[model samples]
Target chain A: MKIAVDAMGGDFAPRAIVEGVLLAASELPSDAQIVLIGREDSIREIFKEHNFESSVVEVVHAEEVIEMGEHPTKALSQKPNSSIGVGFKLLKEKAIDIFCSAGNTGAMHVGALFSIKAIEGILRPAIAGYVPQLDGSIAIMLDIGANADCKPEVLAQFGEIGSLYAQYTFQIERPRVALMNIGEEEQKGSLVAQATYPHLKANKRIHFIGNIEGKDLFTNKADVIVTDGFTGNILFKLGESLYEITKQRGIQDDFIDKTNYESIGGSPIIGVNGNVMIAHGISSPTAIKNMIGWAYKQVQANAYLHIAQALA
Target chain B: MKIAVDAMGGDFAPRAIVEGVLLAASELPSDAQIVLIGREDSIREIFKEHNFESSVVEVVHAEEVIEMGEHPTKALSQKPNSSIGVGFKLLKEKAIDIFCSAGNTGAMHVGALFSIKAIEGILRPAIAGYVPQLDGSIAIMLDIGANADCKPEVLAQFGEIGSLYAQYTFQIERPRVALMNIGEEEQKGSLVAQATYPHLKANKRIHFIGNIEGKDLFTNKADVIVTDGFTGNILFKLGESLYEITKQRGIQDDFIDKTNYESIGGSPIIGVNGNVMIAHGISSPTAIKNMIGWAYKQVQANAYLHIAQALA
Candidate 1:
């Protein structure tokens, strides 16, 4: 199995990316190979700086780079030789089992849709975030920033798709799926949520646990938390901010520590045809290293295949 | 100034309500008075338990009690003699400078609309929550749980009214107003947010600071945080939960401590003709006591009159 990473992504670029890949290479399974896609010379220089040499690492040269501010469609089309473009090409051709990047988020999202594409029955592919629960577990929250505006049907399907991902990937049997809402009552919420509740309830695909409030976010209330990207993104980012806000005040707690974006490193774009993860633009070497760990688990879970099969 | 309170409200009801009033009576100004509306006997019994007697505390008989789960409109009309019903009646007749309760939130919101009505030219009355900023100051967030669904115009108006309220009530001149969105860019966020952006920006009534993300929530980025009720309620509750979640783990921080619901006690109904506050249903004595402090400040600020004059 091969895991492809974009070396010319993120703020730190080739240095942080290559250093992270090297960190992952030390613990790599014999069957797994790390594929670094970017300027070959730049990656080699970073590898040499750390005196790291590994047979498990391979570099594929790409001439162009996609900056963080570049428009997704425009950049991908104009720079087919960019690292993101090349990484997607490898994943599409079955050369890599998974593709991970901390680069232009829009570019990575657009590249995935343009390359492997969404699963046949998927209405929309969502970006799923990992929320650190108080019980030392993680809950999968979908549509973190993908579909900002979601119809009732789209939201209900998020419940179905998110449940399947959690059940297969996280190995939670009949994973409890809950709608992110203001009130726990079925009738309470925005018009979309009110309309979506019935659809989720009628659907036999997921174990609908009714609505969960904002206070229930880290309470280990549900395995799969579903909402439109707007609410989900704000809530997820607020949860992530706990770490930095508390740390700046010289305060520390075990649960708040997990709220750090570095702990998870990346968020997966679910409902797509294959494994694709997008990390923070400010991702450090440690964040990249942790993202690689998740990438390996995602490859092993192969939940996309399960999602496709279930829909079929 | 006559400050009326519903003693037959909240989970603890007359006991906590009477006790909290007793606690506030000690600090009550010579010219200010607390009018407790509920079963007079029940209230006096609790006051006796505390060995408290004060000229500042007065009780009005309210024969009926509205349960927490009762329908707002229906309960108000049917239970005309309920504590909440009597409190609103007093507010409507200008018998009290302000009315406060920890009863059913729906009931309080509906009662405000039915009695004092919304301020002229106001699109809607929103529940404004006090968000504790990391800087030790408080920012006012609007539409916490009033209207579940709000049009773009309603959201933009929240920014204007919130700004006015913060300026006059919090005594901040030219308070920075911001829209709560998924991204800082004006073009980003859900369809409603995208449409609402231009309205807030164009409104000359406010000092618009553009979009603020969830991470900017406690960072004191804006004095007035504007959002639709659905998103605002979820985010506010999530912020409030930080207190309990950390408290259970034996993790304590002064900043996190302020996130406690008891710190400020109650959320005020903004854009209404009168000053009205709705506290948490499970409000304790300390919470009620703190809420009274805010109620006193709200009356002194007289922000409603300012908003009414501005809209006129």
Candidate 2:
């Protein structure tokens, strides 16, 4: 299997990406191949310091880099030779099995949506992340900063996608899918949620588990929680901030500390046609390495195929 | 000043409400008075148990109660003699200086909107809460679960209300008001947020501090953070869950233990013409007592007058 890496994408690009690539290459199966996409000169310099074999890891030259601040669509169109653009192009052409980036998420999402495109029957792609709950359980929340304004139908689709992803990835059969709302009652919630609740209940594809409040998120009330991108993004950020604050508060608990961004590694962009992974822009060497490994596992599990089939 | 209490609203009911009313009557200045509204028999029985003789404490009879699960609007119309309905009516008639309830939030919001009415310049009433941050700071987040569908102008109004509330309640001058978005960039957020950004930036009423991500919520990045009701509710719930999870993990910090529903009292319903306090339905006796005291302070502070003046 071959994987494409956007070497020039994150805050600690090229160097960290190179180190992660080399680490992943060393530990990966003997038949695995890695392609690094970025500016050739910088990548070559980093590669020279490591003295790695050329057969296992190869570099593909790209002329430009998309800055984190650049507008995603304009940047991709203007800088087609950028590492992210080129890596996505490679994925579209099936040159690589998976495409990995720890770059600007907006740019990554835009690139994936227009390049790889959404899976058949999927309205919009969603980003799914595992949030550590109180009982050492993980809740899968989706559309964490994808499309902000979503219809009731879109949210129902998210429920289906989230349930399928949780079931396949976490190995939880009949994973409970709950819609996030202010209150647990079906009558409670915003207008969109009120409209979506009955639809989710009627759908046979997802295990609709009624409404789950944010307070139940940390508890094991549901395995997969679905929400619109606006709400999901807010919840994700709030959870992330809470973890950071608790860790910074000098509480030396291993469990809480282990749930940081580094521990979670990366989030998978579900509903895309191919396996696409997005890491935190500030990911370190260890995080990048884990993300690469995660991408490989997703490919091996054929998670994308299962998700497409479930949605279909 | 006279305060009206919904004696049969919360889980604790007449017992806690009666106790809170007596406590507030005893602790407040001699000029203060309390009117407990509920079924006369239950209110009288609760007051008899207290055996307190103060000219300040009185009971106003109401024949019905609104269940926690009942629809707010429908219940309000069907049960006009309910504790919440009668209390709000008393408030509307200028029979009480302030109205307090631990009833259903939707009922309180609906009752407050129609009965107490919105402030002159306010477009819609917003529910605001203080989210405790890491550095001994608090970020005031608004519209936690009020309006589901929101306009850009409504979000801008929330920013103004939140900023003013933070300034008056938390004593933060020149409070930074941030629009919650997926990213700090101006271009990143839902369409509503995007449209509101320029408006918030141009408005002189608030110290508009650009966009803040969910991760920035607990980092002291902004004193007042504004978002639509849907996203804000999700963020608030996530924060509440994190706080709960952190406490469960045995991180018994004073703030966490104190502020959990058991402590820190209730949330003041802002944007109303008068001071209307809403406590958690599952509030403890101590929380109920504290909420009464909080209501008394707001009445004394003339919170509504200050908010009106500031908005003006």
After TM-score superposition, what is the CA distance of residue B165 in candidate 2 from its true location, in Å? 3.1
Question: In candidate 1, how many Å is residue B224 off?
Answer: 0.4
DockQ, per model, reads: 0.87, 0.66
Which stretches in model 1 have alpha-carbon errors above 4 Å? none
True contacts kept of 1: 0.79
Model 1 alpha-carbon miss at residue B306, Å? 0.4
Query: Candidate 2, after superposition: displacement of residue A168 in Å?
Result: 2.3
Off-target runs (Cα >4 Å) in candidate 2 are A22-34, A47-58, A310-312, B19-34, B40-57, B309-312
Candidate 1's residue-wise lDDT over A89-206, tens digit each?
Answer: 9999999999999999999999999999999989999999999888988899998999999999999889988998888788889999999999989899999999999999999878
Error of 1 at B73 (Å): 0.9
Task: Evaluate model 2: give its TM-score.
Answer: 0.91
- Candidate 2 per-residue C-alpha lDDT over A122-193 given as tens digits, one digit per residue, 9 for 90 to 100: 988888877777677788888787778788888888888878777777778899999988777788788889
List of chain A TM-scores, every candidate: 0.98, 0.92
Worst 10 residues of 1 chain A by lDDT: A23-32
